[model samples]
Target chain A: MAAISVELFAYPWDILEATPERFLDHCVALGVTRAHVTVSYHSGKFLLPRNRSVRVYFPEPGALYFQPDAAAWAGGLAQPVSRLAGSGWLERLARGAAERSIELSAWAVFFHNSALGAAYPDLAVQNAFGDVYPFALCPSHEAVRDHAAALCRSVAALGIFSGVDLETIGYLGYFHGHHHEVTAIPLGMAEKFLLSLCFCPACRAACGSAGVDAESLAAAVRGLLDRRMQSDDASGGQDEEAEHVATLLVACPALAALIRLRMETVTALVKRLSVEAGSAKLAAFTSSFVGSPSNIWMEGVSPTDVGELVECFHLLAYAPDVAQVNSELVFFLALTSDPARVNLTLNLGLPLTTSFSQAAAKVEYALRQGVRRFSFFNYGFLGEARLRWIGDLARIARGDSR
Target chain B: MTELRAGVIGHGYTGKLHASAWLANPHAALTAVADSDASRLAGLPAGVRGYSAYEQLLADDLDAVSICLPTHLHAEATLEALARGKHVLLEKPIADNLRDARRMLMAAKAKGLTFYVGMTHRFYPELREAKAQIDAGAIGEIVAANDCVLEHLGFLNVPQWYLEKKFAGGGAALTSGVHLVDRLRWFLGDDVRAVAGRAGNSYFGADVEDSGQMFLYFRSGLSAQITFAFMREEHPLVCDLQVIGTRGSLTVHTWQSYELWNNSGRQRKVFYTQEPHPAKVQAGIAGEVEEFRASIVEGRTPWPSAEESTRAVQAILAYYESAATGRLIEIGDLHAV
Candidate 1:
């Protein structure tokens, strides 16, 4: 097994509230040499049980934690900032990390901004039925692409981060974990893929440019989704998801070309953003709340296409045991040839890793598969005991006695 | 005058209540009961007829029928009974969706047959008393209200259809919280202008949600918040509501007790403990059934009209729409859909 290095994922508010010294001390105790702090994020109501301050935190919508290059994003579709940036909390944390010889990286979310989308409705992802999903910016829009690139460039300009973990860089679907999601109608994989397909003006234009019939495809998708919703039968089981998607693509061959166009659009954006983050490493999450890596296509993410551009792929193996983690790694490895460029990001707390042994086992299995780096999800959201499990995982990875 | 003959289409929990109410109402006689399950139809009263299919029961002699089938079947059953020239008392939530609800209402209107919704909670004595007081300005001008129901309708407690989304339309919100929404609408005598809601199936992880929360904004400057769940296994069923007005506040709990507080330093409380006598508990449904008969006998509209029930359904659907969109949904937009 390769030597293991674990990085802690945290938020800037958590550092300021816990104080840099205390936060870094906890990181060091867990053998964590690096930390990924959220630089740009979307709106959410979080539960921080271990925090010294408020138990619940509602962050500013689409907030940029660090100071952004004001001149860079002039006349942009999205304008969002966190009040904490004025307090210099991120810079203070960065300075603290520099003094302690701990590496800090910016965890930036790019397109999933409800505030920005709401402000510019035309820029958001519009479904085939012409309903705007204000939470997800349509990547086909050049302005949205520019906004994402500017976000990355601004984070890199801070000069306090080693890398930026780009989240939601591609297209988002109808179910992007908004405040109160009422999806009473259980959607099959094919139906969800159909819903996630963007029919925005830019997307349609892109499809037209790619020589694919966009109008008919959108109408077909709409008809299929409506019929499926109205049907009395429940959604098919997970095992039939792939078969269903295959059947759909076969029936609507135009959908295949459209999907490929979307993948190309995502790849082009990642390629552009990587160039913008000149000095900082460009890493992307392989999965989201949409599904596992197997269902990345729902987000217009093709790992094989993206793997060639980004420095690393953070395989979100947020599973309950080593077996699930193994399946995820197998699927991701098949897409990306170099396992060395892959890092395993696991939840260090309950519902995923219930015991120290389970955490150690996942790390060990990933190590055997040639994944050397592991990033433990969430510093403040995790309790003290889970933090200790991280230290044990690091020791086991390094073949240490402790 | 000859008594109105009534038959119950579904023999579920609410169906049984409708059956008992028909039998209890002197103006209405329980004629027949129909259920897909023969077991549910086995123990009917000596004089009452039993049919395996509701179509058979609707064909029999009856003045009105309480359509207590699953939410998805409410429109089909009601429309069929209406075609047979029988006055219909459809259950709460006129239908699962607006289109079907509108269809049922139109069918009844075209046929000139009396149609009413069984928003049974409106007839609960405590709620009725609270409504009377609110009407008499006991609570003054209403400002805000909150309703909560944490029931125990887990997988083992309910039939499979209750947990299925297609059949039940929704879980706790549509099935249980509909009553709360309708009652609040009735108390305020106002229409919900907009709604925002959140629902989850984290507990049972079934096709339907076991929990829901909603915020309703009325056009009359009134606001209400309703939270309900059917996930608690050990927790006893609790259904309560609190209405706050300019002069005072009124609270009703499970139709068992009520309390009123006025700004003038006067507080009045009424409590009915000791497992409310079965007759008293059944009185709400009996009153609902009686009202159904009275509407037909006098050729007047029912207490809770079909339009009122359709609006209640619209509010509930708006809750779902708000939850789905993660934004406040205007009730008018639901009508457009």
Candidate 2:
């Protein structure tokens, strides 16, 4: 495992708005030694924009990408918006960071590109009914794979980025943060999972080559989802999502092979990106929203084989309860190569409804789970008090003060 | 923002209640309060400024306003607050009439202010979990619903206008029934196709109804039968919702949740929050207000937007129309033009 100290997630806008010196000063004051800044990001309509030049809705493709000399890539731009003409943004940060001694980590968002997906809709993920979700780029597509490798190289070229935090580099799922999204069709989580299963040409061909009957499975899935939507039965127990998967797998034994194939695709993509990184360490950013037990399989981004290639697993443990946080760490660690390489991120505000003591306890439990390093979510999003709580946890993590 | 400055309007029962909530909320402070009756406004905790009129309260800087006024004044207070570019957490039954509700929504939108409709159910942990799971499509597609909230009105301590139709709107249905009505539309869908009801004042004799039986048809092929009454026994508050879906069924109450399916055995999940009534009420207000504060600071939309709350008001209005004409009222008739 690569050695890492206390880190705080940040944004370039945060640096530009607060000015690099002031932002670095704030980091120093908070006792943070590193900043994982987003280079490529998505377009968002924030609540109070222009007033405060900080925070974003969600992480999207953030950094510029290089067309690797080895791959034949025709995709215009992998990311939707360009920071444009370098903005001398990375250079300025590197200069500012050099003075403050704050190590910079490029937070790279690989997929979930509205811009690229919209342009090459065929490269985007296709649902069971053949509905193309342009927001999610299919990992099977050569362009996406090529773009990912290029992205890693581009961030490493920034000179200031000492490490890389990889986000959404694998399969994009049904879950998205598109505001005001109307779920007109009440699709169950399992049904949505079925829909997220890419029946696109690439996925189908791969499944066929692997001896899995992709065509019949897709039909069966479509029929199952349609029937469930029409059934409206209320007696389903707590394990309905599990039940749905079990029932489907029983009907088509080949479905398990399809899932295994997905894991291989994502693993290969990461390995290629890891090779492209040269010396920069890769940290897999994994969060299943709220303690989803089967998130790795559901998203098809298992961190087992890539442990040697990747630096650390940046696990998101946002739940308030210490037990829940422990459970999340246990689940991630059981699958991860080295438990010590896991860097757990805890929520300090907004989504967290627990007290500061409870939040501190979550950090304590995560540390007990053999997680060596720790990082809070983006410094700009949380309230000042939560930021203070981060300082308190820093103290608590070291067992220096209560 | 570290903390939010909030004020409560109308020193009615809930007004005093939510003011204390704001004070107790870690993210909020009860900076100012307004009540028409000075006597009602008396005995407030220290440091909270007082006002006789809501307009005076609006003059002061406020991030959000919790309108605890009567049903009649809900629209005016909310409008006054929104017009001043303040976020609002108006209590249920956003307005007495749909017109005022629309006006308030438009004003809030024009200013880009968040309007959070305060529902007590939002505070219940188990209820919120059920709502989230339902939103995630756990129980296939909804086909039928059964919901009821029965309580004795005499035990409900409030101002005198509650007995008057003009001030409180209708009695049992508007006050207590709106909670379940909002929950149904929220958990089900806002596209309530039809509504029919029969209500009476025989129990309380307050000129407003004490018992209400309302039936609602949803566009998602789900029909809900809701019953609300003012029970005097005080045995306990009976509030539960049972939703039937194609693949499964779920019965959710404040304290318990149960899921049942065709071939599977029923599973019951019970959570006990056995605090006293006053403590529960205080917690509910504080939880909602804290959430409202967080929404403002975090730049996120509040749960169940004002537009969604309007559907609750719309359903109640349909129920009234049905009771008046002794016929089913199509929900489309209540749609704002």
> Per-residue lDDT tens digits of candidate 2, residues B1-337?
7878888997665776787688778777888999887755554567788999999999998888899988888877888888887899998878768888888888887888888888777677667777776676677777788998766443222346766899888787888788888788777765788899998877767888888899988887678999988754432456788888777777886544445444355666755422223444556677778778888888888776667777787888889999999999887654448
Chain B TM-score, candidate 2?
0.89
Q: What residue runs in model 2 are displaced by over 4 Å at the alpha carbon?
A: A1-4, A47-78, A81-86, A184-186, A234-240, A289-294, B1-337
DockQ scores for all predicted structures? 0.01, 0.01
True contacts kept of 1: 0.00
Error of 2 at B266 (Å): 62
Best lDDT goes to which candidate?
1
Q: Please, what is the whole-model Cα lDDT of each candidate in the order they appear?
A: 0.80, 0.71
| Best candidate, TM-score | 1
Q: Which pairs clash (backbone N, Cα, C closer than 3 Å) in model 1?
A: none
